[model samples]
Target chain A: MDKKWYWGIIFFTVAVNVIMLQLTTRAYLGREFEMVLPYSIVGVVMAGIAFFTFLQWKKVEYKEDEK
Target chain B: MSECPKSRHANKSKNDMVNLVDNVEQKEDLKFNRRAFLKSAVGASMALGLSTVPFSVRAMMGLTDDEEDRVEIIDLDQLPVGESHKFYYPTEKDQALLVHTVDGDLVAYNSECTHLMCPVFYQKEENKLLCPCHKGSYDVNSGQPIAGPPQRELPLIEIEVVNGKVYAVGRQFRHG
Candidate 1:
């Protein structure tokens, strides 16, 4: 896979994290547990995914030079 | 020494397969764990939403938004003489009490303590409404505070018995 593909995934995960964070705050303020729980879980999961994708991007850039 | 092309091709393919498996097992970290996350998120949200709903919202949810004028209190046969039932009347925030003083005689009143808004429950043994907060007591028959800090009577709840069912139709508060 191209190094650029991993970068794109990283950006996408970051976007997801931001959106979920906003949703979580709204739900908390509204005092709607129906929205808060799901949004918090999704936000944390997206953050985890983003961290892992960043690691993948680093691995892609520093691959061994094939002779 | 000359290597056979077929054997060389086979060796390369096996190495590629091994590398592919290793990459999938160790380095493919961006895989979205959709199934597990979805299961946990949905289960948690539903459990919390159902359990933690505020009392007011839960009451509103029980009755449809359009129909707030009338609320069913209880069944007539369920209330025997000398027993009282606590329920909501007029609105979800308003509490009311229903009692069958005697055979074929049903009475209802707002259960809030007129002095401080504390909930009042019927004491069947004493046959009076007792507010545990301040020991305020209201007469079960007249709803007038007979003892303690209460200064007024509990609002009367007009009850309607339709086809063996009891409904709180309206409320009457003390004038002046």
Candidate 2:
């Protein structure tokens, strides 16, 4: 429920996404080249979800402080 | 744990408005530290997991072995004096090219691109081995990659002519 906890979750999610992207790129390219298109798309989706969740948590925390 | 009476007594007169704010800020700081510790643990484990995937896949694909030795023999007369032929070497999965150069010399090299393992095809007009995947080129005579992402020369398959029959003796890894 804390801001730090939410930030941790976001960082964890981003780390997982990066690991997945690296795996996918290595599998498809047989080398650590740039992230491929499909992996990039998935990473963007995961990051968007994390950002949206963080924004919603910030809004709730602001409302609680006002009350 | 028992609290020290001396320290407790000393703290009785130290209270201030700023200390209250400091206490709240300290609680947040502790939470952030805990979060950071957890994140590092998760990141390390995830990195370990990610690194293992490639090794596992390589093992499954038979690419994990350091030695991928192979040999093949082709007929000298069949190769002609200025032509080339594609042949599978010691392993069917490994492809190679036998080229009879314009100077009337026999040469053989692996057909897989060093960059990404794409199959390299002989381009007669250009007199080079071309990878369709990335447009990489290798010299037909020397098997040296001349263009594209290939950083190493194509592996040469050593050959010896025995009774006019070409025999691949060993293989050599070439790097620029």
Candidate 3:
């Protein structure tokens, strides 16, 4: 995959996670809900997946360059 | 007497080694300073950000508006058991609901959904408060979202009962 695409995906994932966190906190404040923990965990997992995928993509590029 | 070539080479190598050591020490110092600067910068920014939040929000999870003129105290007997009464407390624009649960616990929350600020309705059949706009369900007792997109627990309004009269005393904002 293209490096730019990988970077774009990373940025987009981070942005989405941040927006979700903000919305979650706002909702919690408004309602005093307890689901913020689960939402945060999901956000963290999504971020990890995105990061892992980006790293894998970079590894593949490195291997290609070596060849 | 001319210095031996070997001695000159040895001196040159020693000078080079000294320069390398100095360069390494400088780089290490730079790294330490950079880290210290970033840490302080981040700490300062975080403190500023936290302090900037509105005082009303920072007070407590259940403290409402401090403005006495905007609060309207209602009687508890006015609302029957297993039913909810919608009223405006603190401000006319902000609507709140006082729900008398089947178990006889009185709970108060903002009738607005935490997700999109849409009004939420009490569902007697489901025994859950429903946010029709987003299908969010909140447990009537805790004002916690049991399902749907809303992540925050409902803002809890503190109430006091005296001689059958209910007064909206404070509001609490709960976060996860």
Best by DockQ: 1
- Model 1 TM-score, all chains together: 0.43
Q: Write the per-residue lDDT of candidate 3 for residues B1-176, one digit (tens) a residue.
A: 55333433244332322234335475556456533443443333333333323322443433452453324457777777788889876678878898888878888887888889999888877778999987899998888899999877777888888788877887777633
Model 2 segments more than 4 A misplaced: A1-67, B1-72
* Candidate 1 segments whose C-alpha is farther than 4 A from its true place: A1-67, B1-68, B102-104
Arranged by DockQ with the best first, the candidates are 1, 3, 2
What are the candidates' interface root-mean-square deviations?
11.7, 10.0, 9.8
Our model 3 lands, by Cα RMSD against the true structure, at 15.1
Of models 2 and 3, which has the larger DockQ?
3
**Candidate lDDT values, in order:** 0.65, 0.65, 0.65
Clashes of each: 0, 0, 18
lDDT of 3 by residue, A1-67 (tens): 6766655555555655666566556544554344544555555665565656556665765565456
lDDT by residue (B42-101, candidate 2, tens digit) is: 455345434444544543454434444434466687887768888776578878888887
Q: In candidate 1 chain A, what residue range of length 10 has the lowest lDDT sum?
A: A58-67
In order, what DockQ does each candidate have? Answer: 0.06, 0.03, 0.05
Question: Alpha carbon lDDT of residue B41, candidate 2?
Answer: 49
C-alpha-based local distance difference test score of model 3: 0.65
